[model samples]
Target: MSGLGMFGGTTIKYRNPTYTRDHGSLTLTWTDEWKTLGGCDLQEPTTGTDTKNREGTLSQYTLYMPSGSPVADNAQVRVDGQELQVDGMVLRIPDPLGILPYCKATLKAWKG
Candidate 1:
């Protein structure tokens, strides 16, 4: 967390879905307690085209956590009290130089 000092103050909530069988019907439920991660850097929103061929805002975020952070692709993101969907690919930035030991996850999302 030494190099991540520049990306402090903001906290991002990562939500994961859970499924259960309710009377022979599969029910999906989201966890009430989200995994809160600190030291996240959220970049400014940029305009982009979505899969539906419609114009929308694209936001990129970087999370500073351990190497095996639970946050995964298509995971729900809640920031600034707004729920947002994780779109496209979730990339993991590797430290090839062995300089920074902290794990960084980069995610791009389409803003609704």
Candidate 2:
């Protein structure tokens, strides 16, 4: 409720704070919506799949976690910003594409 002419005009500028959706499901604090999901696509020309039998590209992937889901249950969590040190926690991005077309992440807890 700051700028009045902010729909379609050149004089539609405001001086306020800005934020982004970079913090998906990770920021569900108030409600049960904490921690969202990211997207990933898989198609042909990446996984080196046979163009005939095993043809495959970037496999679509998103954020997925169940409630009461133990972080040790083959969970693939991509930790950003700050890193935590846990005795039974392991974070890894299986593919090099991070979250491009084809990527895999495995955040599991190491059983020492």
Candidate 3:
């Protein structure tokens, strides 16, 4: 736990993915099992110039989940009614004593 009380600032929604084969095709359809995850902190989104096209910008927010959170790497997140995808790996942060481990991931959306 962050002694600064950074967690529990806002609510988050996550959808664990379940894939199903399409009939006999090689394609797989992704299905979502939406669940609500509370006691987490969603920081304000920061904008930066789009590296690919420079014409628009990209927005990213850091999400801090509580220890033993059920949020998964393949899960999609919804914050403040905006759908954001996980930009990278979900990292576990632990204190020097290896206790009170928490998870952090970057949620990103492109506005171009």
Candidate 4:
């Protein structure tokens, strides 16, 4: 256990693509699961240069979950019945020595 009771007593719906089956066709199925103690933190926008040396603002968000929580890449996260975009990448912050205590995921997205 992380021993950190900062779940905020709320849950978030996690949706991910399961599989596709058809006659040479692509079918996307979303699997939904309720994750406990899920929290989201929005960070201040950061100014950075783009590939063309153009400055842009990037919004950051950190999603908190319990240790050993199953969160996949490109998964759709819904909080309070609203979907939020998870951009860039999903990073997992584990405990020391890869132990399972608590974990946090950082991603970038725009405000919705």
In angstroms, what RMSD does candidate 1 have relative to the true structure? 4.6
**Per-residue lDDT of candidate 1, residues 7-103 (tens digit):** 4566889886666899999865677788886766565444533444456655565545544456665667787986665553355556678554544
Off by over 4 Å in 1: 1-7, 18-29, 48-66, 101-112
Between candidates 1 and 2, the one scoring higher on TM-score is: 1
Best by TM-score: 3
Which candidate has the top score in lDDT? 3
Cα lDDT of model 3 by residue, 17-84, tens digit: 55556776554233555688877987766654355567656778889998777776656898888888
Model 2 error, position 41 (Å): 10
Ranking by lDDT: 3, 1, 4, 2
Residue range 1-112, candidate 4, lDDT tens digits: 3355344455767765555888888765675564533543433335531232334434555676666556666666776665654553456666677544454655454432
In candidate 2, what are the lDDT values of residues 1-112, reduced to their tens digit?
0122111111111111123355473321122222423222112223332233444322322222222222332223333432211222223323344331222222222221
Worst 10 residues of 4 by lDDT: 48-57
Error of 3 at 85 (Å): 0.7
**Which residue pairs of candidate 3 clash?**
none
Clash count in backbone of candidate 3: 0
